[model samples]
Target: MAALCGLTSMHKIWDKLFKRGEFTELDVDEEVAGFAELLRERNARRVLDLGCGAGRHILHLSKLGFGVH
Candidate 1:
């Protein structure tokens, strides 16, 4: 029960931050471009972006010809 309450509080904080665009950068991370290049070299066609806040990486990966989830 305590853990659930903590999780709920954390979720609310994050939700507020997201609503304010705190971590919502439209530009992809610098590391992601290099990582995507490596994926391409390996013939990777899909990516799973865990904890994908705001979906910036999703958009970038999709633009680079990889399916993103």
Candidate 2:
């Protein structure tokens, strides 16, 4: 379908940019940090990083030992 093709095209663009490290310095903004704190406080063992983009927060959570997906 056209929508699926559009998504594939977008994915290719995003992948190219990410592979070039264009988003490596993406900020772990206040909201995300707050979420991380909450997870830490609750001793969460797993997290679902929905729409994780370049994976900044996912990587952060993973470093803190959560089973991030």
Q: Show model 1 residue runs off by greater than 4 Å.
A: 52-54
What local lDDT score does residue 10 receive in model 2, on the 0 to 100 scale?
A: 94
Task: Judge candidate 2 against the unseen true structure and give its global Cα lDDT, from 0 to 1.
Answer: 0.86
- lDDT for each residue of candidate 1 in 1-60, tens digit (9 for 90 to 100): 999999999999989998998877778777988989999999999999896466787788
Residue lDDT tens for model 2, 23-64: 898578888889989988988899997874778888887887
Native-referenced Cα lDDT, model 1: 0.86
Give candidates' CA RMSD values in order.
1.9, 2.1
Question: lDDT of all predictions, in order shown?
Answer: 0.86, 0.86
All candidates' TM-scores?
A: 0.78, 0.70
In model 2, where do residues sit more than 4 Å from their true spots?
Answer: 1-5
